[model samples]
Target chain A: MVKQKGILYDSTMCVGCGECYSACKKQNKLPETNSDFLKDHLSANTYTVVEQHGDLYARKMCMHCAEPTCASVCPVKAFEKTKEGAVIYDAEKCIGCRYCMQACPHQIPRYEWSQVSPRVRKCVLCQNRISKGLPTACSEACPTGATICGDLDDLKIEAKKRLSEGSDKYYQHIYGLDEAGGGSVLILASVPFEKLGYTPNLPKQPMPQLTNRVMEKIPTVATVGGLFLGSMYWLTKRKNEIAREEKEAKFKRNEVK
Target chain B: MKNSNASKLSFWKIVAAVIMICGLYSSYIRFTKGLGASTHLSDSIPWGLWIGFDFLGVGLAAAGFTIAVMVHVFNIHKFEPIVRPAILTAYIGYTLVVLLLIIDLGRPQNFWHPLVMWNLHSVMFEITWCVICYSAILTLEFAPVVLEKYNLTAPIKILRKISIPVVILGVIFSTLHQSSFGSLYLIVPGRLYPLWYSTLLPVNFYISCIAAGLSMIIFESYLNARAFNLGLRLDILSGLAKIVLYVLIIGFLVRITDMIITGKTPFLFLPRTETYMFYAEVIVGTFIPVYLLSQAKYRKSRMWLYVISIFTLSGFVLNRINVAVTGLVASSKTSYFPSFDEISITMMLVVLGMWAFKLVSTKFPVFVELENLKEEKLPEDSREMILSE
Candidate 1:
């Protein structure tokens, strides 16, 4: 069985050096979007960035949820959650409906709006490197070891160890540990995650499960609704036919008189 | 006015011709320049005017199923006169939605991908399939009108025999997709404003669409009478107007109760554009229409009925816009208004829809089968119910 890969980002250790940002660009062959990385936002070209929050820094990229909303909402099934734990996209299969952009709780997906044939874009979590037993581009390029890669179980244990060891030094919560039903990428921050510009208060339920719950009932609705209408059609047709027959009988009796 | 048809057609024809030319040019630029250059859309605002217009079209087009159920399923034969026009409006409305979707898609060439690609979990996938199925059902429903004109009795007989089943399928498909359109936004609770977002969104969409669909039928019937020089069926329309009133009350109650029960009424008092727009939608779409419709004179009068329908339609448009665009503003931190290219294309499509309606009404027996003419008498209490104004 393929072991699930993961990344644990210790934002306190991040020096805002932006080595991972450049590494991601080099690895993905994306064009240079900004000379200063701090001002850069996620875009079709730039998949990840180091954001400075007062005294600390964090990297913004795909959360790689265990069960992703993009994969759920896409009509064409263009997004897939791979065994390696990366949610990958196939532009070849994309129809550019942008439901992924609308549905992503993190608002992470960007679009190639300038192209005639645009594709939704986001970080792939370095699926190619991880599949070959290599760490992700960002984790490999972290000079200070802020971003570390390992099996998801090992990473969770490691994140818990650091949080327990330095209770005063870190916030009590792991940002992505159970957010929207948790993702492979977890963050340990010195400040409250929301203060560090993280999306907070997400429900523990996986986002897709919210929509799927209603979707599961559709078949019953269709079948039951069809039966009800069919029964009504027959019932109403019979009633109308009887009324017509009574009116005709009266007309014939009057004519005979 | 119906007798002055040639002059009326000429003026509207010139206006439509001008809009069509501009729309064609805009479409060319949109395809060539791509979304980034052609519209004000961005990563934060992936949807804009086109999507809002789509909601309007799909919502209004719902008359197809509503009238079909009334005549064919329930066997309320009094509504048989307006069934053809309602279906034609629906056919045109769905066609407009497809055209707009193609124009708005980043990869227009891949429009058919949704057919073979199945994502049962996706609301969009469900809506797409429903629209496709409903469109086919609509075609079958409308076929007899065209077939009768060609004196094809054999096919018409088959259509007549299968009419009840076709109407049933059409209603089921319409209910699924119309509600699902609201479900499309359920996944974006954080982005959509609290005033518009609720777990009952699908229910709200379904109930409100019934109101809009019924209003659209009223609007079209009156317009058809004015266009074709036919006598107005005040009894039938007033009966429809009463249903619209009850639906408006139910829709209003659902929305208000949901907001209060979910503790979203606080968001209602916020000083945001969304709040204002929500008020606008409720007032124009719900409150005023309900108020005007409740009055005997307004419900029965030809001019008042037309005004009330327009108000209800405008309110629906506002609610959709608020749901699609305005609600996301506070979270997105960016406001969006459609660009000229977007405006022109939408206008062009609407004009094209009108032209199609005109052509089909003139060419086919769209309202020729007035088989149910027992509706000449108005209700005794409906004072000032002018037959044709």
Candidate 2:
């Protein structure tokens, strides 16, 4: 088995029931999180949430991307992409640098602030449950089946089938289908994703793709720079040597004369 | 190392002990209370005083690498006496950055993730690696003095033999990381206010660091003369001031070009704090310094040179903070100010760095002008051989 899988969520069908949020907390043993704005809006404990749109609802979670920026930017290999297409973080190794937070395009990674030793909190897509052949808590608890999980190919087909059936009920776009180098989680909606707080400006290319051209040149610059400096040193030393020798010869000639 | 006519033995020792105790207490709070509790940082302002000071400290300390390159690589023997002190200043500044980073990191323990995970694309990774490497190079380059202090003559001889290569390596590393610091903000194009954001951020950072670094050396020299009654060398300092003038002029030119190209010049006139800071940074930091250093008589004055350096240093500090926090916070909809604990911790770290520098310089013979053996009285034939080598 390739182990790569993901979820497709249709926001048009979401009823704002929030069964997915409650189910996720129970299944994952997550502590109770109050999403009230009165407190700090961003935190480490609540990995995912249900966002409200004008007439629709959307689920916000980690994208589990094929090209994960968080994984790429992490210096210590603290973030690992499992074969099952889940980007898992090892708390034991995380140094709390927050570089991952800066790199993620969707801004999915949340920091644990209330605790003494905070860890990065994010949706892992329940890899443990998936390994045991069970649906994630959100999908299982979804009353209207707004969320579905399966192979990426199968999810694409399911999304297409809904789009073609058209009836003007579903929008023609899938939110994460190709955004940020193809995230593991996909979305379908009647309204446009931007209206639901999804970032429409993210590039289709992977985050690192924009930076690789620059990173590749770092070593070359260092090497050539080193050589140029060394040569200058050699030349300057030679000039000083010549000047000193001339001064010595002049002193000796005067003495002999 | 103790001065014969110096003040009471108990006074300086007590001061050092008191500073050490305060620093230790601050460190304890930082470790036990967590960053949020100990720091004034919030989501709106991720970076604060520590980051601000790091830029200021490192930018001023750029004198270290710049002087090293001139003396060792460019073979400017005129700057030879100042090289070791400059390098030492850079070493301390870089070390402080690491200390500040530890306090800044939310999970200080996970700091190793960047090295182990190999995030090859992140600018932060490049910066982290470059800083670590450069610090090592600085340590190696400064080792000859330590070796000589301990009378380890063989290692000193070997270090002299490799000094050229080490200096070259140090220059390369410093350039990469200095620009990398600016590049760290490049990816945040959307978040960084338009006034501070520029495609030429890396280049701007490099040039400004060099200019600020030169000014710092002049300022430090002035301070030393006053504090220790060291002889003032007007010839070399004025020569350095000229270079500083040229760099400031170029830096101002670049800032203007960047603003025009990015069409951010219009924003400079807007009724906003960023606009105000933008002008303050450019006008006060660059333009004024350029004007001050341009005059021959002004450049010759130790007092005026120090004053201009202080202004230049302040401008650099404000520019960094404006970009990293002030400009950013205004847009993010939350006002972030460092709590008392945060400021205290930052001050404590700075005090520690100052004390460490004083201790090291007092004990070592770094700033002394040691004449070569060839220049000393010796047998003529042997002196000729030494001179040739």
Candidate 3:
């Protein structure tokens, strides 16, 4: 079995260079929107953005969750978590209900709302290149050793090593290590994640686990509820029939008398 | 009387025709120009007016199953008079829902994919199947009405024999789907505001819809009375209103209790737009109607009953909209307001439903008087004899 690949992004080492951003756009074949790169956030045309928060810079992209809420909520199985740890999308299977957009905890998936036939746009962690034994475009293009791509298990050890060695400067946490149930991509920031525009207070448990608790009961409810209702109908109808029969018998006896 | 009826119908027909034309044109533009040009939806907010309207349509049409359970499974014969109309409204409402969904889907042609592609984990998947099943059930429940009009005794007899089971299945399907609508929001706790989000959201949806469904039935009763000149059955209408009152109280209690338990009660006091909308929804839609309908005099009076029903119905609409829209505003970077085309299409759908209801009621024996004629033709005692066997 192939080991699951992952990315470790150390925000303290990032230099706010546009190389990763340009590499992402080039690799994805996305058109330029002519918007200011610094002022712009992620959109249909931009898969990766290097956002500057004060003096520290953080790169925003898909979290590639181990148990993605988007994949769970899609009715048609449009999203899949590949063996290599990348969460890929199949536009062919999507009916565009946009439940994935709503269900995503990170809100990373962007839609091509402008096109006649729109598909959800998001970072796939360069699954295509990874499958061909190459590093991700963004990670390869990084000049500083800010972003590294390798096996997820190794990345976790590396993240812990950095956190312990530089405990003074670091926030004493890996942002995506257990956030939203542990995504493949992990981040180490100097400041708190919320200050860097990352959503805070995400539950440690997987987001899909919350909804699955309710969804798992659907079959039982349907079957048991159906049986109960069926029996109630039968019992009620029988009781009504017995009452009518008694009334009919009483009327006949009265007539005969 | 004939002239007046003709004038009223013609006026509505003109209005429906005009709206339908505009709607068809808008749909043409939508299909040709794409959702980007035609709708206000964006990547940040993919669901907008159409989704909110879909929720409204399903919530209002909830009467189909509620009335079925009341008259058939529970054997509440007094409500039998309104059952056919309620089912008809649901059939129409569901048909409109399906239509709107097709238009809203990015790939409308692939709408049938849900049947073959099974994702049991998804609440949407469950809802899709339930909707298809319940729509069929609605057809089966309402078929006898059309069959009775043609005096098709054989199918009518068969349908009557199996009516109990059919109604039971309908109720089961409705319960699952109605609650599952709230389940759609469950995965979005981070996005949806705390004031509306809760683990018991499905229960809240199921409870509120019961009241909304009952309110719809009452509102329809008054409209049928005026339109068909069938004098309003104040007895039946008041009985329904009384039930609505109890349901409203239950819904209110569940919501408030859930809020307090979840510690969301304090958020209700926050001077925010969502908080204000929540207050409006609870106050205008729930509390006022509950208070007025609780009074015996108000329940007995036709005008007061209608007013209360309207408030309750609008409250249901507001609640659905707030859940779909207002609750997500804070988290979403982009603010959404439906474009003119979106609003017109929704209006067109409502008008189409009204027209369809009018056409069906006028052509078929929908009223109680006509149903009495059929009952007289086949005596109740003989039907009971057939049933017992």
Candidate 4:
């Protein structure tokens, strides 16, 4: 397997500038959703947005989890996680069931609701650029190196080093490192991740595994259930037949006597 | 007599015409525009009335397998007479579900993708396969009678030999998908309100549906009795209602015990709008029906039994809606009510199903016992007699 690529975002260093947001739009060829990036949220049109929580600015986008719930729950297998660790989607394969939307722990995918033939739209993590050995548009546009893109392994060591070096300056935990079975995107925040608008209390175990545990039992349930019903039918039918036959024989014996 | 029959038919025809026109218009809008224009759904809340109703449709249809297993599997011939009608109701229910799914889908044309593409991990995939499988079995189970209509003894013979195994398969498929509907929500525990969420969801769904489905059969029987003038034995309905009582007790115990075990008692949270729905579902749906049906007087009376079944069926409706829509409102952060198009289309489907049921029951031999059909009646003769009536 190829080494997975990941994005490292340092919330302590972001400057509330809208450069990364605008760069994302340009890279994805999406129209400007809002004039002010601070007010913008993730939408069908907007892939990434910079949110300002008091003085701190945090970027919100797809987490690109190691085992994505979207990929697992899709009946058509529309969502795929590339070797680069970016979870991507194929519009052609989608029947637009939106189970992915309901199933996503991060709740990242957005539907193109206006179009008659709508497709689920979300960040592809600049998969094309990553394939070409280049950084994502957001990271490239980040002036302060607040957001960096590289191999996930290297990013993890770097994130841990930053945590140790600036122990007093960070929250002492890397967001997304183990949350929902650890996404490729890692975050270093000055405050708790939840305070910065990230979802809280997600299990370290993967979200899909919870669903898979039940799904994997289907074949066995079907087999056992079928066998039980068949046997019940046989036993009941045979018992009723025996009762009928015995009654007929007794009536014949009484008549002969 | 002929004059009254003609006028009555015309009256219903007019009513059907009005519903169909309005429903077709709403459906037109749903197709031309998109789900965004037709529904109150948004990015935050992707599912709404259609998905909820799908759950209700599939849940109520559980009677097909219940009746089938009772007659074909358990050798309970008392329920054998109502099996055809139950199967017909189920076939219509599933067809309506498929239609609604198409209307609700963003890419309706790509609906067939699920047939070819496989994701064994998805509950949706499992449900899809099961529904398709069950619908086919329903057709097979109902086919011999239709073949008997035309005196086609050869195909009827083949259907007879395979009938037992086919019914067993139908029961198996029904059990899987009915519970899988509840399993659909298991993945979204964090998003769904905890009161309705649990590891025992599939079990809860299965048992509750069994109760609701038997109630549906009773409810349908009363309507059939009135419309077709068929005197279904009171004892059969009583027998079925008794089964419903036992099911209700089991279902209530499972649900209440699960709630206690999961520590999601409504007492934990202050009462809200959803809390009222929970009360309506549990009390009106389960408690009142169970209390009334357990008594011999209530169970024996046709009027009391009819009303009790309605109460139980409504409770089932409320529960499905609560699970699909109301429970997620807190997480969605957006209140939702169905759009005019959504409401109209849903109404249209119900009316359409009722109309189809009438047409089929009248044209074919749906009520075998009441018609005195010991041996299959000649199709040509029965057709004339039925039409004259």
**Best candidate, DockQ:** 3
Residue-by-residue lDDT tens digits, candidate 2, B101-185 = 8777877777766666676677777888888888998899888878878999998888888888888888888888887777776
Question: Per-prediction DockQ, in order?
Answer: 0.63, 0.42, 0.68, 0.58
Model 4 agreement with the true structure over A1-257: per-residue lDDT tens digits = 77899999999999988888999999999998888889988999999989999998899999999999899889999999999999999989899889999989888899988888999999998999998889999999999999999999999999999999999999999999998899899999999988999888888999888777777787898899888888888898788777777878999999999
Candidate 1: clashing pairs of residues: none
TM-score, chain B, model 2, is 0.89
Model 1 CAPRI quality: medium
Docking class of 4: medium
My TM-score estimates for the predictions, one after another, are 0.95, 0.88, 0.94, 0.95
Q: What does fnat come to for each candidate? A: 0.70, 0.54, 0.69, 0.72
Evaluate residue B165 in candidate 1 and report its C-alpha lDDT on the 0 to 100 scale: 77
Tens digits of per-residue lDDT for model 2, A1-257: 66578898988888888788878778778777675412223356566688776657778889898888788776666788888888999988777777677657786787765556878888888989876777777888999989988887898889989998974988788888888878789899887778887877677777666556566778898888988887888897888899888988999999999
1 against 2, candidate with superior lDDT: 1
Q: On a 0 to 100 scale, what is the lDDT of residue B346 in model 3?
A: 91
Which is better, 2 or 3, measured by TM-score?
3
Candidate 3 local Cα displacement, residue B231, angstroms? 2.2
- C-alpha lDDT of residue B344 in model 1: 92
- CA shift at B71, candidate 4, in angstroms? 1.0
Quote the lDDT for A63 in model 1: 96
- What are the candidates' C-alpha RMSDs? 3.2, 5.2, 3.5, 4.8
Please give the ranking of all candidate structures by lDDT, highest first, separated by commas: 1, 4, 3, 2
